[model samples]
Target: MKKSLITSLAAVLLLSATAATAQQKSMGGMQDMPMGKPATGQSVHMARGKVTKVDAGANLVTLAHEPVKSLNWPAMTMGFQVKDKMLLDKLTVGRMVDFEFAQAGKGYAITGVK
Candidate 1:
C-alpha cells in the first residue's frame, strides 16, 4: 500500500509539473511586445458604431462602438476628440464614421474622416 501511495503521489506531481510548464509557455506568448515607445505616425481606423454623445464644450465625442478595423479597442462606447472641430460639423449623433486619427498631447484627435 505504501508503494502504491508513493506511485500515485509521484504521478500527481508529474502531471502538475507538466501543467505548470504549459501554462508558463502560454503566458510567455502573451507578453507585451517592447517597441520602446508607442508607434508614431499611427492612424487609428475607428470601429463601426454610432456616436452616443457629443460634448463640443469638452472637445470630446463619445461613441457607442465596436472594434475599429484600423484600431484596437475593447469597448463599445468611447470618447475621443475630433482631430479638428471641423470634423464635428460632418458628424452627427447616430451616424457612423470610418475615422482615422492618432493620439496627440491630449486624447485622440482626428487625422481623417471618411
Candidate 2:
C-alpha cells in the first residue's frame, strides 16, 4: 500500500509540474517579466485614433483608437500614460493622431505621436 501511495503522489507531482509549465508558456514567458515597469526592448505597438481627452496634469491621454494588429486588440477607447508630460502637449481633444506605444507595467505608455 505504501508503494502504491508513493506512485500516486509522484503522478500528482508530475501533473502539477506539467500544468505550471504550460501556463507559463501560454503567457509567453511573462511570468518572469516585472510589473509596474516596462520590459527592456519591448516591442512597440502602433495605432491610429482620435483624441478624446488630454489630461496634462495626470500625463494621460484618452483615445478612441483603431484596431491594434500588433497586440491583436480590437478598436476601443482607452487612456494611455505618456512617456513624458510633453507628449500631452501634442494631444488635443477631437484631434486625429498616429501614435506609437509600448507596454508599461500593467498598462501602456505612449512613446510618440503625430
Candidate 3:
C-alpha cells in the first residue's frame, strides 16, 4: 500500500511539473517564443509602439509607448530586432507610427512601418 501511494504521488508531481512548464511556455520565460494569432486560434495582428532607441549595427531598436498584443507586453519598454535596414531610417524616436513585424523564430523583425 505504501508503494502504491508513493507511485501515485510521483505521478501527480510529474503532471504538475508538466502543467507548470506549459503555462510558462505561453507566458514569458527566458527567450520565450513569439506569440502568433494562428497559434492562439485567432487572427493576430502587428503591435505598434513608439521608437525609443535604435541601433543600426545590431539591427535592433528599443520601443516604449504602448501595449503589444502580439508579444503580450503592456505599455512598457521593449526591444525588437529589425528585419530590414530600410526600417532604420523610418524610425523616429518619440513619434507615434503604425508598424508591423514578423517573428523570426526566436526574436522579431519589423517588416512594415507607415
After superposition on all C-alphas, the RMSD of every candidate to the true structure, in Å, is 19.0, 16.5, 15.5
TM-score of every model?
A: 0.53, 0.65, 0.56
lDDT of 1 by residue, 5-102 (tens): 65555454345435433544564443322212325644444445677666664455666666543333344454566667877876678788766655
Window of ten residues with lowest summed lDDT in model 2: 29-38
On residues 34-76, what C-alpha lDDT tens digit does candidate 2 reach at each position? 2223356777778899998666655777788997766555577
Please report, as a residue range, the 10-residue window in candidate 3 with the lowest summed lDDT: 36-45
Prediction 2 TM-score vs. true: 0.65
lDDT of 3 by residue, 31-112 (tens): 4244444432433346668887666756766666466655454565556667779888888678676777655544445666
- Residue 111 of candidate 2: its Cα lDDT? 86
Give residue 23's error in model 2 in angstroms.
17
lDDT of 2: 0.69
Candidate 1 has a TM-score of: 0.53
For model 3 the local lDDT of residue 109 reads 55
Clashing pairs in 1: 47-68, 65-76, 83-110
